[model samples]
Target: MIKTAFALSFALSTCMVLPALGAEQFQCPLPSNPNDPAKLEQIRGLLPDVNTMKNIERLNATIATLRRDGVSKSLMIDHLVGAYCLMVVREAPLTEAEKAALVRRFTGQVTRLVYSLESGLDIIINVPLTPDVVDAVNSVAEKQGLSGPAWIAMTIDDALQQQRTTSPPELPAGFSSSC
Candidate 1:
């Protein structure tokens, strides 16, 4: 009787644990083709913020330019995904909701860019905007009385700098620069 009870308990525990383990497994599917906007949107729905969204948009634009310049779609997608990972790592912790928002935005933008590239869309303009790329774009946009890539770039740069400031920097031996 005790053996029977033990077996039942073990079975139940295994069943419960399996689902929990599965739940923790996040399998992000890379689109089969770079032009599948829908698939990209699905992936983007996992990120955290507006700045991330903007960065993804800028990246998409850049990728589109690269595609026009003869880069392959697969390579472009790989590069974008790599860039996304870099940005996420560089940025700090985010709430669940923020992360979700970022994912959604990134997925959508990536999808669109992929589709555009696949369709052989012409590169309208290339804006090399980074979180640091903002200042130049902003200065020009401001003078022309329009918001441009610089605005987002500057915003990201400021936020990232603020993050850097809040966190203590690691000092090297014999480095006497003020913190």
Candidate 2:
């Protein structure tokens, strides 16, 4: 279980990078619903194979980049899962014990960070977009045969990915804020 803030950060990496237990958010199971799993799978497919040490280091480096960018903890975890574990749960034939560990891995990390006020089943955030943006999302959603909500979720993930790639690395040590 996670103990300190350091442990909390380490947990994020291990949940995807070190785990035999693959995770979904909120300590939940890998989704059985085709709609969401399909979404997860799409993100999953877009990532490099994370089964190697170099890829693990690459993902950990991404966390460092996001941290420097001052992203929220939830967004960090979301990206970690998307970048590493989504492909895992889909492709690996895990045992029952492994699945249970998956549940524990996320639950432990989440327990250290948040208190739940809603059912895990309905754990979601409502984001408000401009009407024109909504119309564009809707048009694209319809063309792809995806529900509006699902497409929006996909778009958010895409935006997060863009943010991840574009965030600049840390400045050199001599570039002091002490001016």
Among all windows of ten consecutive residues in candidate 1, which has the lowest summed lDDT?
12-21
lDDT of 2 by residue, 1-179 (tens): 11332233333334333334343422332322334455454444544563422454554454455557664545545544543444445545765456445534433333222222324685588877779767866665544334456544544544455567799556797796455
Error of 2 at 164 (Å): 22
Q: Which candidate is the best by lDDT?
A: 2
Model 2: how far residue 95 lies from native, Å = 2.1
- Model 1: per-residue Cα lDDT over 1-179, one tens digit each: 32443343343222211112325332233433547564444334533333655566556556656666664444454445534543443445654344434544454355345544244564445645456545654543343222553233323333444457599776799998767
Candidate 1 lDDT at 104 equals 40
Tell how far residue 127 is off in model 1, in angstroms. Answer: 37
After superposition on all C-alphas, the RMSD of every candidate to the true structure, in Å, is 22.9, 17.1
Clash number for every model? 16, 0
Instruction: List the pairs of residues colliding in candidate 2.
Output: none
**TM-score (C-alpha) between model 1 and the true structure:** 0.33
